[model samples]
Target: MKTIKILLPIFIYILLVDLSYAQSKQNKKQSLIKPVVEPPIEVERTTPNNPDQYQLRLIMENDAFGGFSDRYYTNGSRLEFHMSAGESNPTRKVFSYWNDLFITPNEKTRYLQGFAVGQEFYTPTNIKKADVSYGDRPYSSRGYFTNSLTTFTEDTSITTELELGMIGPSVGGKSAQINFHNFIGSPTPQGWDTQIPDSYSVALKTDIRKFYHRFFGTQYNVNLGNIQTDVSFGLIFRFGNVDKTPGPGSSALQPGSPILHEDGKGYWYFYVNPGGTLQAYNATIQGQMGSDKAYKSQNRSSAFSNWDSFLNNPTPDVGEKELQYRMLSEDNGKNTLQRYILFNEFLVNGTTNPYNIGLNYLIFNNIFNGAEEIERTTRLFLLSNLSAQWDQIPTNARALAIYSIFRPEGGKLPPIVRYYSYEVLSQFILDPKQRETLLQLLREEAEYRDNKTYIADLKRAVGFIRAGFVSVSNAGFLFGLHYNYQTIDFQAAKGLPQQHQWVGFQLGKVF
Candidate 1:
C-alpha cells in the first residue's frame, strides 16, 4: 500500500507535466496564425425616437419569416399587425393585430390609451386520437381575447390601467398599471381563468427614484392576484450622452444598448433585474376517463367496472360522451396530471454599450408533493462583449464570450458539469489573403489532434468568408468572415474517469 501511494503521486505529477507541455505547444502554434486588422471609421450607429412612432421591421429566422408594422397616427390612435409562416408547418399560420384609441385628451401631463388585440395560433399536431380506451389524448387548443385601457397622470406621476380578458376557451379579466417614478408597471391585480364568475380584483404599485445616488437607480414592480403573484426590481445606470432622436440619422443613444448605429452616434445603458413569481391553478377533468379519482380506479382494474358510470353520463355531466370524443380527438386523456411550479430569476443586461455584459440565473422547483414526482433545476449564464468601435471592424464585429452552469436535483452522479467556449470575431471587406491563412490553421489543428493518443482534450477552430451582399438601407453591402473554436476533454475511465477532452470545428457561422 505504501509503494502504491507513492507511485500514484508520481503518476499524477507526470500527467500534469504532459498536459502543460501539450498546452504550451498548442498556444505557440496558434500565435503563429496571422491576425487581420481593419480601419476604425467603418462602424455604424442608430438613434431612438418616440415609443409611439410607426416602425416597420422584417425578421428572417431559420424556420420562419415574419414582418411587423406599428403605426401611431396623429390622432393618438395606433394600429399594429404581425404575421409569420414556416416551411415545415406550412398549414399553420400565426396572425396578430392591435388597434389603440386615445380616450383621455393628449397633453403634456396626462392621457389614456384604450386598445384591443386579436390573435390566432394553429398547430396541426396539437390534437391526436388513439384507438385504445382510457388512453392518452394528444390534442389541445389555446385561445384568448384581451382589451385594456390605460390612464396617465403626468402631474401626480401616476398611471392606471384596466384590462378585461379571457383564456383557454373561457373568458377572464386582467388589469394592471404603473405610477410615475414608480418602478412597477401595473396596479390593478390580474387574474386568469378563475372559478369565480365576473369578479373584480385590485392592485397598487409605486417606486422611488435615486434610491442611493445619481448613478444608482432602483425600481420595483409587484402584482397580487387571485391566481398569480409577481415582484420584480431593477437597477439601472446611464453613461455618455447619446442621441435619442428618431429617423435614419437622429441619435438618442443610451449606454448599454446594442451598438449597431450609423456613423457619428453612440449610446449606453446598464441594468440588473431580480424577480420572483408564484402561481397556482386548478383544473377539472370530465368525460371518458373523467376525474382523477375515476382514472386512478380505472387504471388499477383493466375490467370496465364503472362502464355505466362513465359512458351513460349526459351532456355537461361529469362523464359525457361527446366531451370524451373531443378529449380523445384532441389527445387530452393522460394519468390526470396536475402540477405547480415556483421560480426565481436574476438578469443583467448592457444595452448598446461599448462594453456589455449580461448574467442570468434561474431556479425552479415543482410544488406538487403527492404521488406525482417533483423536479428542480438551477441554471446560470453569462454573456460579455467588447465593441470594436475604435477598430475598423464590421458594424456587428465584437469580442464575445459566454459561460453557463446547470445543476439538477435528485439525479445520480454529480451533475454532468461542463465548461465550453471562447471566441473573437471581426468583419472587414472580404480579404482572400486572410481567408487562406485561416483555413490553413484550421487544417493544422485538426491534424495535430488526430495524431495524439490519450488525447483527453482537443481544441478546434474555423473561419469563414461571406461575400453575399443583402442591402438594407445602404448599410454598405455586408461582407465578412467568422472564426469559431471549441475545446472538450474526456477522462480515461481506468486512470481518472474525470479526465477527458473533446473539441471540433466546422465551416460557416458557429450556430
Candidate 2:
C-alpha cells in the first residue's frame, strides 16, 4: 500500500510539470501569431495645394522727391512691370525624387525665399531749364517791364529704371524686401541743353506689408546716387489662392507638380508728395514798380528814348517811314536772339498792353505706330500786358496783306497806338495729315526767320511794321489750358486724358 501511494504522487507531480511547460509554449506561440498593438499616432490634415511659387505685378507711382524739378513739392510719374521667384517653403518636402538629389527639407524654415526683377520708366514735369544758352532771351533796358523776356523756360526729363531685389519672410504681417533701383535720365531732343549728360541715379528701397499676402505696406526709399530720401506707403489687392500647405498621401516618396497655383490678379498704387508749394519769392514786377525814378533811370538808354519819342509822335505816314531797328534782348544776363518771342509772334496775336495776347501750340504724337496710334495735345494761352503809353506808326492797309507783313498805303492822318495780330495761321486745321504738314510748316518758319533777307527786312520795317514793336511789359497775367491723351496698354486698350500745366511748386530757392 505504501509503494502504491508514492508512485501515484510522483505521477501526479510529473503530469503537473508537463502541463505547465505546454501552457508556456502555447502562450509563446499565441504571442508570435498575434501582431503587437502600437500606441496611437496623430495624423494632421493638410490642404491639397502648396503655396504660391511665382508672382507677377504691375506698378504705377508718383514721387515728389527725387524728380526732374529743382523746386520742392514737384512730382514724377512712373509705370512698371515686375516679377519674382523663390522657394515657397523649404522645410516641407513635397516629392521624394528631390530627396535623392540631396535637397534636404528643413522643417524650421516656414517663410518664402526669393529674388525679383523689374523694369520701369518715369517722366518728371515742372522742372526748370538751368542752361543759359538755350533758354535766355534779351530785350529792352527797362528791366522791370518784361519777366518772360528773361525767364520763360521749360525742362524735359525721362528716366528708365531697372530694379533687382531679394524677398524675405513676413514679419508682423508685412513682407520684408530689399531692393536696388537703377535709372538713367534722358534729355528732350527739342529743348536746348536740357539733357543732363552722363547722368544716372540709383535708389535703395525697403518695404514691409500685410494685406492679402502683403497687399499693404510702408516704403522707405533712399537715393544712393544723390542726396534725396523718401518715405511713402502703398496698397494692393490680390485675387488668388495664397496657401502653402503640403497635401496628404505619399508625396514624400513620389514626384509632384511644382506649380502651386494658377493665374493671379493684383494692382499696386502709391502717392508721395511733401506738400503744396508756398509763395516765397519777391514778386519781380512788384519790386521793379516800387519806384518810378528807378524805372526811368533803368530805361534811360538812347534806343528807349528814341522808341518813346516815335511812339508819342506817331502819324498816319509813320507807318510808311522805314528805318533799321535791331531786334535785341537780354538773355539771363547777356544779349541773345529773341527766338522764342519771334516763334511766339508766328503763332500768337499781341496788343500794346502786354497782358492782352492770344496764343496756341499743338503737338501730334505717334508714340507707337506711325499713323494708327497717333495722339494729339493742344495748348492755348492768353495773357494781358498794359503799360501807360507807346508811339506807333501810321496804319498801312493792303487788301492782300499777309498778317505779319504790311504794304505801304500813302496816308498821314494822326498820332495813334495800334494793336497787332501776329497770326501765322488764321485758324487751326485739325486734319491728321494736315497737322503733320503744319509741323513741317513751323520748321520752315523757323528757318525763314534765320534767313538773311528776312532779317534785313525785319530790321528796316521795325517801326512801320504792325508786329514790329515786340514789347513785353506787365507780362504776369496769364491763362492757359491743355488737352492731352495717351495709350497705356495695348492688350486691354487702356488709356485716358491727362491734364498738365507749366505752373507748380512755386517754392523759391530750391537748393
Candidate 3:
C-alpha cells in the first residue's frame, strides 16, 4: 500500500538503531572503541511551510473508453491535489505583492499548488432520445472547482487557474448519467430532462511552456469565461525517459507522466503531445452565454412544427461560425471543430522512497468539430422551415439518395458520398407537387438526415480514437482502460448501427 506508506519511516529508524547498539555494548565492556553509523537526513521542502510532500489525482473520460457507442464527447471526471513545487506559492497568501510580479523566486522555480473537483457531461446521438434530439449535442452538463498555481523554470512553465462552476440540470446530468447507466447495464440517458440550464460559472485559465530541448517545445493556451472562450498553440514532443528539464512530472500523466524521486529512485517514460484549438465559445456547444435557461423546464417544442411551436421554442443559438449554406451540404469535417489532439505514452515504473508505481500505454487521437453544434442546429432547423416554400429550398436529395442504400458507411463511404444522391433533387424538384412536399419533409426531417453527415475527404474525421491501459500507484495514483473510437457523429434516420464506441476507465490516488 504505497510501499508501506513510504517504508514505514525507514522501518522505524532501523529499529531505533538496533536498540541503541545493544545498550552501548553492555556499558562499554572492555571498550573496544568503534562506533560509526549515520543515515536519515533528507531535506528540500523549500517552504509551503515544509509540506513534506503530497499528491493525488483521479481522472476519467469516457465514450466508455471507446466502446463504439455512447454519445458526443460523453462523460469526464476529475479530482486532483498536489504539493511541493516549493520555492513559494502555498496559495501565495494574499498574492504577496501581486505574486512577485509573476513568480521570480530563484533557485530554479518550481512553485506548485493545485486543487480540483470536476464533472462534465454531454450526450446525443441517441442516448435513447426521450425528447429534443433535434440536432443532437444538446443535453449538457458541467460542474467544477479549481485553483492552481505553478511556476517551473529550467526551460519554462507557468500555470494558472481559477474556476467555479455549474452549467445545467444542476450538473447532475441526469443522475450522474442515469446512475452510471444503471451500474453499467447501459442505456438510460433520456436527455437530462433537456439539459443546459442553471447558471453562475466562472473561468480563467492559462498555460505556458517554452522548452527547447528534452524533446522540443512550445505551448500557449487561454480560456476566458462564460464557460469557455479560447486561444491555443501547441507542440511539446518528448522521447522516452525525457524530463530532466521541462517541468511538472508529479505524475500528472499527461501522455503519461510519472517522475519525482528524491532517493526512492525509479523511472521510465515516453510521451507525445500534439495540440490545436480556436474555439471562441462553448457553453456546452453554444448555449448559456448571456441569457440562458435552456428553455427553463424543457420544451424544445418537440424539435418544432406544431404549426410553429411557440415560434421554435428555445433553439436558435447556432454555431460553427454561423453556417448558412443551405440546400444539400458539406463541411468535409462537419461543424469545423477540427482541432488535432494526440497523445501516446508508455510507462513502466516502480519506486520506494516517496512511493511510486507504474504501468502505461495510452494513445489518444482527437478530431473534433463534428458533432459540436449539431451541424449548426441542423441548418437552423432547415432554414426556418424551408423558407416559406422554396425560394430555393427543395432539399430531399432524391430521398436522401434513396435512403442511402439502407445505411452502412458508418465510416469510410465518401466516394463523393452517394447512394444515388438523387441527382440534385431530381434535377430541381421538378414540380410533382413540389417534389412531394420536399419528399415529405425529407422523411420526417430526422435532424436533416442526422445533419446529412459529409466528409468528402479533406483528410478524414468522424474519428476520435482513445487507446488505453494505465496503472500507476502510490506516487500519484491513476488507473485506466481505454479503447474509444468515433466516426459517426450523427446519422440516424432509423438505422443506428453504432459508430461511437466506448470502454474507458481511470482511477487515481497519491497522498
Candidate 4:
C-alpha cells in the first residue's frame, strides 16, 4: 500500500512538469510566427501639374546714380563719384515683378533651367530733380535743318522695362539668371522742360556674382546692367516647394512656385519704404547779389571771422562749421549777402557711404572698438537703419551708457537703457519695456536746446527701427537699410553730376 502511494505521487509530479514545458514551447512557437506591425511607411506626396506651381518674384530697389561733369567742381570733389563716392546723389524708387510662364518644362539643361518674362517700373522722385536727354530721338520735321544741332530734351518720362530672364543651375541654396531687358518710356509733356525722354533701349543685365557662377546663399543680389550701367542691389525671398534634391541645372526651390494670385499659394504683401528718396536730395541754389561798395571796401563782413572761427574752434555747432555760405540777395536794397547751407547733412561724424563700404568691407570689419564698435557695426550691417538716429546719441552719452553697463566702478545706467544696450548689442532684441524706457531716456536727452530737434528726430527714427526690427511678425520679412553709390557714365558732356550717394531702406518678402 505504501509503495503504491509513493509511485502515484511521483507519476503526478512528472505529468505536471511535462505539461508546463509543453506550454512554454508552444508560446515560443506562436511568438516566432507572429507578424510585426512596422510604423506605416510614408511616401512624400507630390502634386502633378499643379496650377499653383508657377513661380513669382518681386524686387523693390532704391537706386542712386551720381557723377560730376567737367562743368562742375574742379579740385576738392573731383574723384568723388568714382563709383558711389560722390556727394551729389540722384535717386530712383523702382519696383519689379516677374513670374514663370508655365511653358518651360521642369527639365534641366546645360545652360537653361527655366524661362520668365516680367515688367519693371521706376520713377525718379528726387528733391532737386533734373532732366536728361533720351538717347532715342523720334524723326520730326522740325529736325530736318537742325539734324546737325543734336538738341537734347529733358527726362520727364515714366520709365518701363520689359525683362526676359532664364534661370541657371543651383549652387549652395540659390539660383541665378541672365536678364535681357528692353526699356520704353511714356512721352514727356510737349515742351522744353521734358525730363528723361520717352525712348527705347535694350540692356543686358546680370548679377555681379554671375561672374563666378556661385550665388551666395541667395540673401542679397548685386546686379549690373550694360548700356546705361544701371546698377542695383536687392534682397530676395522665396516660398513653395524648395527643391532640396540635386540635379543638373537645378534650383534650390522648385520652378513655377505660385505667387499670391487666384491660384495663389500664400500671403499678399506691400511694403512702405521706411524713408523716401526725399532724404536723398540736396538743393544747389546759387544767386547773384550786389554788395554795397562802402561795405565791400571796409571788408567788415563777419564771413572771414566766421571762417576763422570754424577752422579754429575745437568743436563748433553744426551751423558754425562753414556749413553755410553767404551770397548777395536778389534785392538791390539789401546790402547783405544771403547765406545758405548745403541741404544734406552727411552728418554721422566719421563714416563713409555705401560705395566705400562695399569696396572695403574687409578692412573696416574691425575698425570700431568696444561698445562704439558694436553700435557702428550694427549701424553698417542694418543698412536701411538711418545712421543719423545712432549718430544723434553723443559720444560721451554712449561712453557713459557703456560705462554704466560694463564698468565695475561706474554708475549704473537707467534700468531700461541698460537693458537696451545689451539688447541692441545682441541682435536678439525682444523686450518692449526696454524700448519704452529707451524712448523716455531719449526724451530726457532731448531737453537741451542744442540737441532738442536732433533728439526728437532720433526718437522718431528709433521708433521706426523698433517697429521693423523688434516686431516678431516682421521677422520673416527681410529689411535692409543700405547706402547706394552708383557711378553715372554720362555719354554726353553737360551739367550732369558724376558720383551719387543714396541712403535708403527696402522691405521685401519671398512668396
In the order shown, the candidates' Cα RMSDs to the true structure are 33.3, 32.4, 23.5, 30.7
Model 1 agreement with the true structure over 1-511: per-residue lDDT tens digits: 1222323354345435534664675567567766664323311111121122112221111101111110000001111111111111111111111111112223321112212222111111101111111222101111111112122221111112222222222221111011210333211111111112222223222221222442344433333433123343444332323222111100000001001223223333222222222222211111111122122112211101222233343345534533332322221122222111110101012222122222111000110111111122211112111222225322222211211222221121111111011011101211445434433443443344223211011112211111111111222111111111111111111211121111111111100
**Candidate 1 minimal-lDDT segment of 10 residues:** 249-258
- Model with the higher lDDT, candidate 2 or 3: 3
Residue 327 of model 3 has an lDDT of: 8
TM, every model = 0.22, 0.23, 0.29, 0.21
Alpha-carbon runs more than 4 Å astray in model 2: 1-49, 58-189, 199-202, 211-228, 234-511
Q: What lDDT does the true structure give each of the candidates?
A: 0.20, 0.19, 0.44, 0.21
1-511: candidate 4 lDDT, tens digit per residue: 1222323344345435534654675467567663674433222112221221112222222222122211111111000000110111111111111112111213220011112222221211111111111111111000000000000011001112222221111110010001111121211212111111122223332321111111111211111221122222322222223222110101111011111121222222222212111111101000001211101111112222233343343454635543332111111111111211121122111332222222122111211101111234544553433333446544543453334323321111133433333333322221355445434543443232111110000000100100111010212232333333333322212223434343333332322
**Residue 24 miss distance in model 1 (angstroms):** 80
Candidate 4 TM-score, true structure as reference: 0.21
What total of clashing residue pairs does each candidate reach?
55, 18, 21, 27
lDDT of 3 by residue, 325-427 (tens): 1101221222222211110111012211110110000000001112112223543554344333333323443233222322221122222222123223223
**Which residue ranges in model 4 land beyond 4 Å of their true spot?**
1-192, 201-204, 208-476, 491-497
Q: Tell me which of candidates 1 and 3 scores higher on TM-score.
A: 3
* Angstrom error at residue 134, model 4: 16
Model 2's number of clashes is 18
TM-score of 2: 0.23
Candidate 1 positional error at 211, Å:
8.0
